[model samples]
Target chain A: MSPEATAPPLDESWVPIRVHGDAGGLEVDWCHLGPERFTAPFFDQTVEDRLRHPFALLFQHRTSIDALVERQRIRPGLPVRGLVFHMSRCGSTLLAQLLAALPRHVVLSEAGPVDTVLRAHRELPGLTDAQRITWLQAVVAALGQRRHPDEEAVFLKLDAWHALELPLFQRAFPGVPWVFLYREPLEVMASHARHRGAHMLPGALGLAPREAAGMPTTSLDEYGARMLARICEAGLRAFQHRRDAPARLVDFTQLHASAADLLPELFDLKLTADERQHLREVAGRDAKNPVLPFEENRDEKARGLTPEARAQTERHLRSAYERLEAERQGR
Target chain B: MSREAFERFRARVLEDPTLQSALQATPDLATFLVLAQRLSAEQGCALTESDLRDALDAARRTWRERWI
Candidate 1:
């Protein structure tokens, strides 16, 4: 048989490289990954690593995506295996990295292009819910292109802030399973106190009129506490309103255990004993700092919170934290 | 503009708080290009809106080429 006989047919539409700009206007940075690029063991690489492949030919121009559907003949993405939403500093990345280690899975851990459109939903106030949903579907379709024929599922670990936009995403892909990962509030805050993510910093997300109206103070710790609580609240609301979609709340404590047991069932993934072992090994390292060995530091993390930050967490985050814990315990 | 000219202009903008604010406050590409043109000129780098667009394109290419 000719090699062409077995090769997957190429769809000529460009893979969107990233989204740029705000609500008043939006632009998609598009690229075409040349034939043979996806045929390699590209699934093993990180999203950024795959994106950086030299075989990609990027368009110099940006498009408004007004003609996105007409211009791109996108293959419907592999049945989305699961979506991972989180409170920042949780073990969500570890979960994604473990899933990515599975031979048949394509995991995009916080891919920048995906985050771009989600953030644009807020930055561009003119974008209606319907439009954002359409744009999100297109973005996922572009990102979830099966790089290798063996790939069976694609998982997305969204930026933490995505919890706030849960309803919109649910509207976009209602059939996909979703999970929310969270750790206790003080531990999460303490981790941030050591080194803050851009989202946790004040003014990163320009406040909405509703949020701006209710804020009691704009101090760093207060802002962090309020933002973290809102993220937790959003997760709780989504899980409560899951309706028919498969959704679960995963505590940081349950993560390692779930790697072997619950996660596969949740995502409809089938893992061999060997594959499960490989996943267990991956979980033993720092998911973000994969070069280093993993260490258990929960006690250390709890101790790191100062009295002021601890008091702030207790004041602003206690109810949300208790609520998440209750749901995780199946209460 | 050459890559060097764009780099110089970008550096000057970063160093000046007012220019940074102007860039941050820019609502869209049209405004950004106008600001870039003015800043480039103040730094003696001959720049036009077209040149600024080319510079952005060049930067993207440079980022991709680094992977190659």
Candidate 2:
């Protein structure tokens, strides 16, 4: 064979490339590559080249997560100042979008990559403490890319499932502040059922069709009660674990009434006069709909819980809410 | 979905400098579906038909921009 032919496809000229993985999977793009075939070395070089560069890695392995955490811990660049936690559909989107519109802050809204990373390591039996730390580290690294040092902060609106993983985040970026948002339990249940679809399993409000089909169907009341219980439990757990952390609990009702006053106070963010005005405009628009339109169907819909189920959900939520409030007040 | 099919589809789209430029400019739903349709046809796959249809529906619902 001719030497030219044998020498491997002359490492296709360095060109920017975007590699898309499967749906709901990681997507990465790079500016350029040197003359090297797609090999291990090429991947290593790509990683190095993209250092301090942001790339979304969906379903990142625990090992990868560990490397990212270590990098941030040892050589921390900018602290991830903003993190938002919530039960799904609790006005998180509005808050995140508002924050995103502000200058000097990069907001990753419902980032698919975050979900992928959590799902990747969640199934494993028992990752060591160090391994678990790394998983969170990778997430921070992926979410923490800043083009300029002056870019005030990086904000991440975490996946609902990540409520269970708050401790990991706290351990990774201890300096970062977090906020948790909640709505009335009945309203939350109704909105979740209407928008996300119902599920039979515990804590499974937004199960996809495939996921729902995999589990045995239960009574709508039972499903609603279970979902509410799980959400309350998750919230309480997150609250208890991060008692000392800078956190705020914004009731959905209060947020709807006056987000302008609540949001700036919660985050301690200093907005310019124009920024504050812009925030008021956005908040006013969002606050107009205090009750989610779908709440009316809670009684008539298939996912509507029976009176007994409703009572159970309310009972659990009341206990959880009291505990959360007490913890917040340092009781 | 196969490697060969993916490579072929990529090549076909990249071959057209205009489409490639459009794709580079905006990787939004419209461009993605157009690229997917072209690739699916080149791959001799039936899956592309549904993909294109869904993409059209999504674009109409979200962006309200018709492709054809």
Candidate whose TM-score is highest: 1
Docking class of 1: incorrect
Q: In candidate 1, what fraction of native interface contacts survive?
A: 0.00
Clashes of 2: 5
Residue-wise lDDT of candidate 1 within B1-68, one digit each (tens)?
36667666654653465765566555366777787688778888767777677766665564454312
| Local accuracy of candidate 2 as per-residue lDDT tens digits, A129-174 | 5565555555445444454434557677776656666777777667
Candidate with maximal lDDT: 1
| lDDT for A273 (candidate 2) | 88
- Provide the overall lDDT of each model, using Cα atoms, as 2-decimal numbers: 0.68, 0.50
Over the stretch A123-166, how does candidate 1's per-residue lDDT look in tens digits?
77666788777777777776676666677777888888888889
DockQ of each: 0.03, 0.06
